[model samples]
Target: MIDLSSCLSESAIQISDRTSCSKNSNVSCMISPNSTPSTQNTVTCLYRTILSTRKKILITVTWSKNSLSQGLSITIGEDPSISFKVNTNPRLFRKLKGSKSLEFQGCKVEVFWDFSSARYRSVHEPEPDDGYYIFITFDSELGMFLGDKARETLQKQEKSGPRMAKFSLITRHEHFSGNSHYQTRAKFCETGAAHDILIRRSGELEGRKNSELSVSIDKKTVIRVRSLQWNFRGNQTIFLDGLLVDLMWNVHDWFCNPDSGHGVFMFRTRSGRDSRLWMEEKILHKDEKEEFSLMIFAACKNM
Candidate 1:
């Protein structure tokens, strides 16, 4: 089993040795006494994709929204030293559609995006469910498609040279504020089903003396944390679709500082059988290629 003590930061959370949940679990305690409030609202998705150069690179698509600003950003490669980036705001473009051509790592790259007719499940979600397409072409040899309008984009562009690019989702990071009940979806593997994830916190309910936290997947309660004030930070292991998933949460801010307090939850699964081993220093290893991570940062102003 992976040690949650070395994985979590002591400044943010303390390690708990208490055994809660199931037998295959490691629970760490959380208590950030001076955690400040967070007002960020954004969603970022990182993908591990290969270009025509046969080299691996990472692509980051980010959407950010605040009271006065809302925009989209796409960044290629690991660093800004040699990358292709596009930043656009809906209010400024009105159409929310455009294309840009650039060179990345000595290869010709083209980016096309159309969100004018996109549909969103919620205002908090920056990614659209349908009626949108974001395409990235490398040397006109391969293309990466995001969204559901690949066919529409192909027919309109009439470019038959670039095939589809093979990519793997690395991690999804989201920041949301407002309520205690948060819901999202995650797919542990490429061939696995996308499971509905719900995180809820109950405060001094009818039968409960202190707040409690529960994590559910596909409507099934998988992990529960009791006496949340004392165990605000912890980790658990659960099996899903025959694979082991590491679950971690830190809600110290939610209880200690509610005005702008933020809580964090993470669901991670590895492609290797030794998923029991974790990165002591970093989230990824130099050779460990296939890992899926979902991180949620939720804040509540009222509870």
Candidate 2:
């Protein structure tokens, strides 16, 4: 079932998964509040007639500022490919850092966010449903919103830390598809002089594509990872809120595989961010296709 009024309305609807069905999406519409739905009505009438005849209406959304421009064309299928761009509102960033704040350096860090990707078993015709895949790239080069306390911790370690092998403590959050969407967008916070964190990814790109999707919904994700690395004897002040605070930690890497049973890393994070922090690597070699799997795991610690 589809209701054009919900998403098209002035505010958000109670719907959980807006674009859940592909065929059920019948009305290809572009309802801009600033613009009129004049010519669109004719197209809608014919679409309804087609739906009545064919019993399926695969709708697409396209619009433009000029003559019903189709600059933004998004198809809706079982796994639709959507692409669009807009001038995003900067209120949130301004809210967190104050109106005049611009840079992210030396702020308080309370929590650590992460953006990581793990491949899942690909879907095959014989099996049809092996496992779906998803990729999360944190928007920030550093971690998410961590206030003053986080800034203080990382600076001390960046200056005079031991020269042992570099180990790391990584903080991972739950999959962003759930309620995590309501959390916070990704941003780099370097409140301390030197914290052992690296940016393998930074949130999503300009486009969003899924490998195997049962639904036609388009998803956007934001993530953060708190990682501690070792061996840095320099100016290590955490950077955030357009200021610099002191915080740094030495994170280590502990690996595991099917050959070896498993390894446990110290846990650090809140209940929401702590879930599924580690995904152990699994190796399977039987048929023409050799496969690998990763387990998600995370730990929380007080610095």
Candidate 3:
């Protein structure tokens, strides 16, 4: 079991009347699998519900002199996270502004980036990950800011690969603990060819849960399948044992299966065009050796 009861140990300003987890039993959270907030919110309602001793966040709420909007409440923690209680949205949110503070939940919360932590990859490439980050709460109800990268990356692919050949991974759900079910031979974390940056959006997806392993290789050329690309629509599932799972991540996944290794899965691409699936691995579900057959275009091309 991944334990993460220590990340939020330090508190800048303490909330005196805060309820204790030793007494209550409802506010428990853990560090996600990737150990970064960007991976996944491992701390879920179920985690709280299952814990013997519920964990609760102790916070300070001081109303500031200058207030912008009455409806929004930003909770700033000295740990670089500023939680918000905007009257608009309620899913989960954080933004990309430099160090600053924001008001939330009827109190003035300070904002700053926590650079003490180790360096990790940022899902939104192009955006430099030179330093650490601060957590900010946003109105998920109003709109979202985290998803812009995925959309932008999708648009830049044509300049990266050949036509009717390349496509990108879009994460819809990101949670760990389901892939192991289907992949009895292997665990779920080793499903696709994505970086750890994904944990933030999908919470450390375990078993291809979120089809959002989005990529940004935008050169119009050939992309070897270094990873398994999971199709989100229906039963179009890819597996190691499920399909050419070993072929893609063989450099890493080969430790387990040596003899039956997959060659490579390549795709062609052009920007703003549909992507096709190309397979070169000897061990595959079917055969597509021919040039035209090697090109698997999208079912619906973008007009």
Q: Rate the local accuracy (lDDT) of all candidates.
A: 0.67, 0.19, 0.22
- Best model number under TM-score: 1
- Those runs of model 3 whose alpha carbons end farther than 4 Å from true positions after fitting are 1-98, 114-124, 135-235, 239-303
lDDT of 2 by residue, 107-213 (tens): 22121211112111221001111121111111222222122333344455685632221111122221111110111122222132321221121122122222111
- Candidate 2: where are CA atoms >4 Å away? 1-165, 169-171, 175-183, 186-303
User: Which consecutive 10 residues in model 3 have the weakest lDDT in total?
Assistant: 41-50
lDDT of 1 at 80: 59
Which candidate do you rate higher for TM-score, 1 or 3?
1
Using lDDT as the measure, name the better of candidate 1 and candidate 2.
Answer: 1
- Model 1, 63-152: lDDT tens digits are 777666666777777665544344434455465778878677787778888877777766656566688888887777555778778666
* Shift of residue 38 alpha carbon in model 1, Å: 13
Q: How accurate locally is residue 54 in candidate 2, as Cα lDDT from 0 to 100?
A: 29
TM-score of each: 0.76, 0.15, 0.19
State the RMSD for candidate 2: 28.5
lDDT score, candidate 1: 0.67
- Top-scoring candidate (lDDT): 1
